[model samples]
Target: MSMAKDKELVLSHISLEVRKLIKMYAAVNECTQVEMLERIVLEWNAQQSRTERPPGDEDE
Candidate 1:
């Protein structure tokens, strides 16, 4: 398989429960496991962004 030069592959050891959850979500939505994982990551990023403030962004 070929990947974009700007991208790099990552490896992680995930728990069995999380793996099963990803498979079930992918199957129900008819999407690939990778897509489900990406969705999960995006949601996590958004949640963190909302909770954290950037430098110099303190409340007035």
Candidate 2:
């Protein structure tokens, strides 16, 4: 599968339970496993952005 150049291909080992969950989520969402994984990562990034503060933004 082709992805944008900004993205990097990841090859990591996951637990069987995690793999099954991803498969189920992909099937329910009608998306490929890769898309589901991307959705998960994007959601995590958004969540972190909401709670994290940048340098110099803190009150003295």
- Tell me, by lDDT, which candidate is best: 2
On TM-score, the leading prediction is 2
Minimum summed lDDT over a 10-residue window in model 1 is located at 2-11
Cα distance off (Å), candidate 1, residue 49: 0.4
- On a 0 to 1 TM-score scale, where does candidate 1 land against the true structure? 0.65
Q: State the lDDT at 12 in candidate 2.
A: 39
- How does candidate 2 score on lDDT? 0.70
- For candidate 2, give the lDDT of residue 48: 90
Instruction: For each candidate, give its TM-score against the true structure.
Output: 0.65, 0.67
Runs of candidate 1 with Cα error greater than 4 angstroms are 1-12, 54-60
Which residue ranges in model 2 land beyond 4 Å of their true spot?
A: 1-12, 54-60
Q: Mind giving the per-residue lDDT tens digits that candidate 1 earns over 9-59?
A: 321355678878988999999986667777777888878987797788866
* lDDT score, candidate 1, position 57: 83
Candidate 2 weakest lDDT stretch, 10 residues: 2-11
Across residues 1-60, which tens digit of lDDT does each residue of candidate 2 receive? 333333423413556687689889999999876678778878888789767978768556
Clashes by residue pair, model 1: none
- CA displacement after TM-score superposition, residue 15 of candidate 2 (Å): 1.4
Q: What's the C-alpha lDDT at position 8 in model 1?
A: 19
